[model samples]
Structure formats: structure tokens, C-alpha cells
Target chain A: MDLFIAIFTGTIIAATPLIFAALGELVVEKSGVLNLGIEGMMLVGAAVGVWVSYAGLPMPLAIMSAAAAGALASLLFGVLALTFLTNQYAAGLSLAIFGTGVSAFIGKGFGSAPLDALIPLEIPFLTEIPVIGPLFFNYDPLVYFSFIMFGLISWFLYKTKAGLVVRTIGESPESSHAIGYPVIKIRYLAVMFGGAMAGLGGAYLSLAYTPLWVENMTAGKGWISLALVVFAAWRPARVLFGAWLFGSMTIFQLQGQALGISLPSEVLSSLPYIATIVVLVIISRNWQFLALNFPTSLAKPFRPAE
Target chain B: MRFQIERRVEPSSFMRFAAPVYATFSTLVVGSIMFALLGHNPADTLFAFFITPLMTINGISEWLLKASPLILIGCGLAIGFRANVWNIGAEGQLVIGAVCASGVGLFYPDPESALLLPLMVIAGMAGGMAWAAIPAFLRARMNTNEILVTLMMTYIATLLLSLLVHGPWRDPDGYNYPQTALLPDAALFELFDPMYRLNTSIFITIVAVFAMWFFTERSFFGYKMSVGGAAPLAARYAGFKQSGSIWMGLLISGGVAGIAGMAEAAGPLGQLSAQISPGYGFAAIIVAFIGRLHAVGIVLGGLLLSLLYLGGEAVQLSLGLPSALTSIFQGMLLFFLLASDFLIFYRFTPFPKPIKSGVT
Candidate 1:
């Protein structure tokens, strides 16, 4: 039971960053722009967040700084795709490369440096509940924050007029333009929103999960988030489930290794990524489903005719 | 005075041919600004990064050694990309190839069998093709997004590689480091002089480039791929099975990438290890694009990118710069290239009067 609690705790912490990132991407894709630079942005955010925290800033401030850094990096992507009418794929890839370099350069002095771990808050009566208490009530602030963001994003995407406009832009930018909506500006905002979320997710990794900065520490989580967006069929509720699923796989591999399971540690270590691919293959197996589900103008550059 | 707006004329062929040179020069100018911002000596850093690395014997060999995989992988990728069939999982294919070849190489650990080397290379090619076929299969049968599929496969390959190195492939004699024992000399191929640290994989790379040129320029299949990329609808109407192009593109490219992987494991690293590639598969994507997906052009891009890799390392050692500076430069170059590509296709115009007053 103790081991189960520990494993459950670790899984929530591990899944928090992924949840944050995938949720961010979910919103971005819901708005119809695919930002492959999520990895780069998250990495930059991690570095910035770590560096700011190291400078003796408050942890909350440090988190915000990380989001700002991610937003700035993503804005560069927006300029390329939305303003310059460049290929989103190419622009996204470039941002990834650029963000990686910039973050690595800035983060040189900070690798593996220790910081304060995020402390978990225990609810009084709920904390005493057998299995449910530990699982739901006791977790770092970030874990709870991810769920809040999930709910808020789900509401904003489904229940708001602005959300509908954003969806319209994603579905058909030209028509949105015809309807007097600012397609580019909406996408730009959506991209930045996604970037901020990705950055916070990265900050969670450095400041909470690993509790230290490392070069390229995001380690393809951003890409996994992109895949998660697809896996969830671009829905917010699905994003949470997908993130938890991946989080379980990540923790399961480590737990298996610790328990002296027969499988190779390396294979187990690689299981999350392998699981990501397997899930992608499974979800993408139905081309008709993907085609029917995808936002029609998701990655298409939007240019208002002069 | 009225502003006269004449459409910009297409530059002459000579200027068109020299566009990359101009882009490179512009990139350098931008790079200089980056260096200045970092408070570094631009001239010294640029000279150290670009000129100093190529001026020494060891440096030259290192450059060639690194260039080998990029060239091989780039050649295959260029061919596939030209046909508009992206096989971005070359890294995965490369790892799989190395894994298969190494598997064969491991069983026959002694430096003895005459037929061992050729057999390993064949095994590598087969391994690469098999990995590449996954996305090809999905695209052909399910009409899945190959880009996402191929990209996702890369992570899977990285994990699988890690598993092998850490688990079953871990060297018994060595400490707990996740790596296998070095292959015996008999299993190794002599590509370059061992004394100088040069390997024979460089030669293989050169031959592959020329072969790629011939295949693309002369072969019937090559024409099919070109037509397919240029106009998929037209090609389909012409009865060219899209599936055939996908398979050929994935297989041939995977085979080349596999050989590159095999070469690195057999010729240099001589064992299966976790860090067999330092994002070479992803880097090759940049190489393929910079080369404009042309056979001969890919060779030039490969050499340039290899220089960037070497220079990045040199800067890290000499200037105390972070190793990621190389990735930054590569990313910047790609960003600039995409910008250039946009300018080539569409002319930018100033915003007209607002349809409605909501936009800022």
C-alpha cells in the first residue's frame, strides 16, 4: 500500500508537466495551428525558469518568467507562419532548433544545480481517506494547477464566443476573415497561449520533477505533446486522459526496473516513447477518423488579402 | 510622387544558382550580430569555427568522418523528399540498422571471417528498410500522416536503442555504463587510415552520392518520384501507384541511412551504444532541405552542415561556449532558409484597409 501510494504520487508529478504541455498544445491545435516548436519552447522555458529561480526570485515569479520566455519564443514562430506566410512545418522546426540553442547557451552555468522541490499540500479531512485521499488531495501545487488549467481550457474552448471564433479560424481562416474576425491575431494569441503552457510544463520538469536544470531536459516531451494532441483527436478532455496514460507508462517503466522485473531497464526506460509511438499508430490507424476529426485549416498559413 | 509597384523580375540563372551563397553570407552577417550580443569576438569565433577546423589534418579527417553519415543519409533523404515522400525517421532506421548489423557483429566477435563485413552491411540496409517501411505502410494503406508517424518512430527508436545498451547489450567486462564491447578488428571495415583516425565510410559516402545522382537523373523510378512530388494528382491519374513511390522512397532512403548507421557502429564506434547518433537523423533533415533535395546539392549541404557540427564542437572547447551553439546556428540557418523559400514563392504586400476594426 505504501509502495502503491509512492508510485501513485510519482506518477502524478511526472504527468503534471506532460498534462500542462499537452493541454497547451490542445488549445493551440484547437485554434488550428500546429507548433512543432513545443519542445524548443519548453526547453527554453525550463532554462529560463531555472535561471530565474537560481537568481533568488520567488518560485511563482520564476514560473511566470518561464511562461513569458516560452511565449516570446513562440511569437517568433507566429511571425514566420502568420506574418511572413512561411511554411508552418519549416518555421516550427526552425523555432525548435533556435530555442534549443538559445536555452542551452543561457543554461550553461545551471545544469544539475539543485533547487527547492515543490511541496505538496495536504487537505485536512481528505488526506485521511484511504486510497482516494493520497491520490487526490496530496500533490504539488503544479499537479492541481494542471487540472485547473484543463478545466479552464475545456470551458474556454467549448463555452465561450471567443473560443468559437478561434475554432472558426482553425476551420477556415478565409471564412473567419469574411465574418470580421481577426484570424491572424486569434491564432497568434492561441500560439502564445500554447507556448506559455508548454513553458510552464517545462518549468515543472526542471523546478519540480527533476529539480535541476539539464541540457535539452525537455527530451522530446514537446513532441510527445504534439502526438498527444493527435491522440486525443484535438479535444481537451481527451488530452488529460492521454497525458495520464503516458504518465502511467513513464512511471510503470521506472517501477518495473526498481522491482527487479525481468525486462531490461533500458527497454523500460524507453517504454514511454515506444508507448507514444504505439498509441500514435493505434489512434492514427483509422485515417477516416483522423481526417474527419482534424481541423481543416490547422497548419495552413492565413493571409488576409490586401 | 506615386510609388510604382512593378513585380520583381526573376533573377538570372547565375544569380539563381548563387542564391544559397547569398543566403549563407546573410546568415553569417546575422550570426555576427548574435556573437556581438553574446559579447564574443565575431571575427575570431567565425575564423575558429569555419577556417581553423578545416586547416588541420586531424580536423579535416574529423570533418570527413562526421560528413560520411550526413552524406549517406542526406542522399537517401534528398531522393525521397524530392518525390514528396518524407522519411524523417532516418534516425530510427539508422539505429535499427546499427542494431541489426551489431547483432550480427556481436555473435562473430573474433576478427576472422572473410565474408563478415559484407554480410553486416547487407544486414544494415535490410534493417533500415524494414524500419522505414512502417510509415510507408501506414501512408500507403491507412493514409496516415507520415510526418507525424515518422517523427514519432524516432522516439521509439531512441528508447529501443537505450534499452539494448542498458540491458542485454551491456558489456559484462565493463562497468555499468550502457554500452557494448568493441567489435574485433576482423569485423571492422578499413575505410580510412586507423592511425589518422580516418575511416573508409567516407569513401562509401562519396560513391553513394554519385550513385544517387545517377539513380535520380537516369532511372525510371526516379522520374516517377519526381512527377509524384510535383503533382500527386497527375501522377495518380497517370497510373503511378502512389504506394510504389512510398515504398521505394522509404526503402531506398532507409537502406542508405542504415548503411550510414552500420558504418558508424562498425567503422568507428565499433559497438552498439546509447549515444550512437547525436541527432544526426534530425540534422540530416536540415541537410536535405538546405540541399534543395538534389543529389549533388545534398553533398554540398552535407559538407556545410558537417562543418557546422565540427565548428560547434571547436567553439565549445576553445571559446567555452555551450555545445548547443551548433544547434542554434543550424536552426537559424533553417529558419533563414525557410524565410528565403517564402520570398521565392510569394511577394509580400502591405496590409490593406481593415475589413473591420478589431485587429491590432
Candidate 2:
């Protein structure tokens, strides 16, 4: 029973960052822009957030700084894909490379420094329950916020007029333009939102998860989150399920080695990545279904005529 | 109201070639500024960056040696990318190829058979093709996004490599190093002289350039791929199977890239290690695009990028600079390429003067 409790606790803590990142990408893709630079943006966020927090700032402020850094990185992507009308795949790739180079250049000075973690907050009524309480109520504020964001995003995407505008733009930018909606502006906002969420996810890793800086520390979680958005079919609730599932896989790999599993540690560590590919295969089995679900204008450049 | 100004002018073919050349030149200029900002002399650094390295015979040999894989992989990737098939996970394919080539070499360590090297080369190509088929199969059968699928596979490859080197394949004599035992001399490629700083694998690279050029420019399959990429609907109507094109394109590139990996392992390292490649897969991407996805063009791009890799190390040692500057310069080149592509496809025309408010 205690073992289950510990693993469950670890899963929630591990998943919070993924939830933050996937939810952000869900919003961005929902508005019809595919930003492949999420990993690079998140890495920058992780490094910058750690640097800020190490310089004696409060945790919340440090996270916001990370978000800003991520947004700044993504803004370049937005400009290239939107204003200049470059290929989204190429532009996003350039952003990823740029972010990596810039972060590595700046990251040389702050290697493996010890830092503070986000303060954990337990709710009063739910804290005393047996299994559910520890997993749900005993997490840090970021975990709770991630849950709220998922619910809020689901509601916003389905229930609000603004959400409708974003979806309409995603479906057909020309028709949305015909109806007097600002397609570029909505896409820009969506991309920024995704960047900010990815940044927060990055911050969670540096500030709360590891509490130390490492080169390329986010590893490939940013990419995984990007894939999760697709796997969830751009739906918010499914994003949560995918994040938690991936999060558990991540924690289990390390835990497996500690528990003396026969398989090599490196194989266990890479299990999450293999699982991601497998899931993609499963989701991709039905071409018609995917075509129907995909946003029509996703990754297409929007150009209006005079 | 939003409006686009189309500055319509037919650019000369020379201009088409000139854009990348200009971007390369501009990147050098901007890179000099970055060096100056980092407290280095533009002239001295530029000298160290380009000239100082080429001055030494050893440096030139190293550059050529490093360039062998870049040229081979870039040529293959150029073919697929030209057809709009994004195989971003070539790095993973390279690793698998290296592992297979190394495995075959290890098994045939004795000098009894000359066919051992040939077998390794074939195994390497097969390994790469197999790895590439994962994404190709998914994309053809299920409508999956190849970009995401390929990228995800890279992570899996890395993990698989780590497992091999760290577990079953770890060298027993070495003190806990995650690597396989060295290949015996019989299984490896040899140059003209032991003391000379050349490897025979470069011969393969030269053959690849001509082969890829012939395939892309002269072959029926190559024409089909280009036509498919340019106009998928028309190609479909004309009886080109979309799935077949995707599969063939990825597998051919993968096979070539895998051969490059084999060359690297047999020609230089002579053993398997945890870190088999240092972004060769990703760098090939830039080389393919900068070459304009043309076979002949990729050779030039390969040599130029190889210089950056060599020069980065040279400058790092001589100027006390970070090695990551190579990555920075590469990233800048790609960014500028995208910008130049805009100039290629679309011309800017000023928005017509707004009609007078009361005019019909």
C-alpha cells in the first residue's frame, strides 16, 4: 500500500511539467499552428528559470521569467511562420537550433548549481484521505494549477466565443477571414500561449523536479509533449491522460533500476521514448480518422490579398 | 484590411544560386560581430576560423575525414528532402547502421575472408533502411505526421544505443567504459599508407555523389518523386502511388545514411561507443537544404559545413573559444536559408495606393 502511495505521488509530481507543456501545445495546435520548437523553447525556459531562481528571486516570479523567455524564443517562430511566410517545418527547426545554441552559450556559466524548489502546498480537507489524497491533494501548487488549466482550456475551447474564433481560424483561415476574424492575431496568441505553457513546464523541471541545472536537461520531454498534443487529437482532457501516462513511464524507468530489474538501466530509461513511438503507430492506424480529426489549416501559411 | 504586396520580378538562375552564397557570406560577417562582442578580434578570429586550420596538413586531412560522412549523408537526405519527405531522425538511423557494421566486424575479426568488409557495408545499409521503415510504414499506412514520427524515433535510437554499449556490448577490459571491443585489423578499411592521414572510406563518398546525381537527375524513379512532391494531386492522377514514393524515398536515404555510418565506424573509430555521432544527422539536414536539395550542390555544402566543424575545433584550441560556435554558425545558416527561400518563391509588390474614400 505504501509502495503504491509513493509511486502515485511520484507520478503526479513528474506529470505536472508534461501537463503544462501538452496543454499549451494543445491550444497552439487548436489554433492551427504547429510549433516544433517547444523542446528548444522549454530548454531555454529551464536554463533561464534556474538562473533566475538561483539569483535569489521568488519561485513564482522565476517561473514567470521562464515563461517570458520561452515566449521570446517562440515569437521568432511566430514571425517567421506568420509574417515572412516561411515553411513552418523549416522555421520551427531553425528556432529549435537557435534556442539550443543560445542556451548552450549562456548555459556554460550555470552548470549544476544547487537551487531551491517550489514550495509544496497540501489542501486541508483532502490531505488526510488514503490513496487519492496523497496523489491529488498533496502536490505543489503547480500540479493543481495544471489540472485547473486543463479544465479551463477544455471549457474555453468548447464553451467560449473566443475559443470558437480560434477553432474557426484553425479549420479555414480564409473563411474565418471572410467572417471578419483576425486569423494572424489569433494564431499569434495561440503560439504565445503554447510557448508560455512550455516555458512553465521547463521551469517546473529546473525549479521543482531536479532543482539544478544541466545541459539539455529537459531531454526530449518538450518533443514528447508536442507528440502528446497530436496523440490526444487536440483535446484537453485526453492531454491530461497522456501526460500522466508518460509521466509514470518516466518515473518507472528510474524506479525499475532501483528495484533491481534485470533489464539494463539505459533500456529502461529510453522506455518512455519507445512508448511514444508505439502510441504514434497505434494512433496512425486509421488514416481517414486522423484526416478527419486534424485541423485543416494546421502548419499552412496564411497570406491575405489586397 | 490585411493585404500582401507582391513584388513580382523574375530572378535570374544565377540569383537562385547566389542567395545561399550571399547568406553564407553574411553569416560570416555576423559571426565576426558575435566574436567581437565576445572579446575576440574579427580579423584574428576569422583567420583562425578559416585559414589557420587549412594551413596544416593534419587539419586538412581531419577536415576531409570528417566530411566523408557529411557528404554521404547529406547527398541522401537531399534526395528525400527535395521530394518533401522530412526524415529528421537520420541520426538514429546512422547509429543503428554503425551498430550493425560494428557487429559484423566483431564477428569476423580474423583475416580469413576479404568479403567481411563488404558484408559490414551491406549490413549497415540494411540496418538504416529498417530503422527508417518504422516511420515510413506508419506514414504510408496511417496518415501519421512523418516529422513527429521520425523525431520520436531518434530518442528511441539513442536509448537503444546506450543500452548496447552499457550492457551486453560493454568492453570487458576497459574499466567500466560503455563501448564495444575494438575491431581487428582485417575487418577495418585501410588507406595507402599507415602514416598517411587518409582513410579509404572517402572513395565511397565520391562514388555516392555521382550515383545520387545520376539517380536524381537521370532515373525514372527520381523524376516521379520530384513530380510527386511538386504536385501530389496531379501525380496521383497520373498513377504514382503516394505510399510507394514515401517508402522508397525514406528507405533509399536511410540506406545511404546507414552506409555513411558504417564508413565512420570502420574507417576511423574501429569500435562501437556510446556517443557514435556528434549531430551528423542534424547537420546533414542543413547541408541538404543549403545545397538546394541538389546532389552536386550538396557536395559543396558538405565541404563547407565540414570546414565549420574542423574550424570550430581549431579555433577552440587556438583562440580559447567554445566549440558550440560551430552549432551557432550552422543554425544561423539555416535561418538565412529560409529567409532566402522567401526571396526565391515570392516577390514583394507594394500595396496599391488606397483608393480615394469617395471614389467608386
Each candidate: how many clashes? 6, 6
The residue pairs found clashing in candidate 2 are B5-B349, B6-B348, B6-B349, B7-B347, B7-B348, B7-B349
User: Model 2 scores what on Cα lDDT?
Assistant: 0.83
lDDT of 1: 0.83
| DockQ of model 2 vs. true complex | 0.71
Off by over 4 Å in 1: A128-130, A257-260, B1-19, B175-177, B191-194, B348-360
Candidate 1 lands at a TM-score of: 0.92
For model 2 chain A, the run of ten residues with the poorest summed lDDT: A251-260
Best by DockQ: 2
Residue-by-residue lDDT tens digits, candidate 2, B1-360: 455546346644765798798879878899999999999999899889988888877777878888878888998887787678889888888988998988888876565478888899999999999999988998888777788778877888788888888888888996899889987776788975676556888998899999989988999988888888889888889998888778987898788888888887887788888888878888898888888888878888888888989888888898888887888888888887777666666665555788988889
**Individual DockQ of the candidates?**
0.65, 0.71
Model 2: lDDT of residue A67:
94
Docking class of 1: medium
